[model samples]
Target: MLMALSAPALAHPHSFIDMQTTLVMQQKNLLALKMVWTMDEITSADLLYDAGSAGAGSEIWKKLAAEVMARVMAQHYFTNVYRDGKPLRYMRLPSEYQLSRNGNKAVLEFVIPLAQPAPLAGKPIIFSTYDPSYFVDMTYKSDRALHLPAEATPACALSLFTPKPNASMQAYALSLDKADAPPEEMDLGQQFAQKVTLQCQ
Candidate 1:
């Protein structure tokens, strides 16, 4: 459930939350991840997702959202090769998926397709999120040492989101190319923790 909204912060009524790594696995050598996203009081809520119903403003929102998601995903991998660049190629989803909502919480799920199938042996996969605002906040990050059995195949990946604060705003701006600052140099995990601490205080 959402806490009582403070009037001052209400100017940015919508917030985006980063979901921690919940599960990672390999099926027949392929790697899959699942993620979720949510928001607050965002207008034309239909435009709130990477792909969804759009308002007259929906096209603007869609473009901004795509850029942000692409950038954040790149930062997590410690590369600027965004979406379809080398090292890691961004797998395109249908772009019409809906965010899962329950009361005040919504889940934005992101799936990343690995460049190669997970090796039969264990390997390290680094996952991270960064807010591209004045502070370049990081919401969550973790390094998963994955053990892939011989049978692992390419499977779906997932990540989750809740409505924290400034998440979607940052994403929205990136989608629109109106971000206030370049992404920070600090590692995504440290940057995100610092941003949250600063905001919560």
Candidate 2:
């Protein structure tokens, strides 16, 4: 639900997000995650236009932010955490969240708390974030875009695993025009999302 725009002149991924993530640690447990998304200029422009004359932190701005947050919530925050092969749960609402501007771009920052902090020394922890429709391509610039709590490092580390969409998958994505959406059952975006694997030494 990120956008309902004009037919794309190109394939899927009409929008993009430059993301940075932090693994929040409490003692030896994974407590939460801090996510920062810097949106592309084109997407930022549309968002700003919707904001109108709303000043920073004003009621109007807050309302606008809430609307956007609602979209993210509806999509389950576009995030997932897993241990072994099973999914981990998150709090219904982020412990903290905000939508604002950074120069000509839009920035969203949020802290997603785990329902129950999982210990770092056990099963492998895999995490990923992506838009299911694959209308937007979310990426991390590099491993540098991922971080560990100062207290968690050395003992704990994260490795990014890039996605490799097969030729048919690529073609399917290319076939989607702006208005066309894949079936909900496809879970297309996750197929293209970069995954992070966490392990404590």
lDDT of 1 by residue, 114-188 (tens): 545543233323333444332322244332222223223233232223234367544643443322333446322
lDDT of 2 by residue, 1-201 (tens): 566321244778888889999998887889998999888888778777777767788776677677777778788888989999999999989898888888877888889899999999987899999998888888998999999978787788789999888999999998988778899999889889999999996
TM-score of 1: 0.41
- lDDT computed for candidate 2: 0.85
The list of candidate 2 runs beyond 4 A from truth reads 4-9, 52-55
> Which pairs of residues collide in candidate 2?
none
Error of 1 at 72 (Å): 7.5
RMSD of 1: 11.7
List the global CA lDDT of all models: 0.36, 0.85
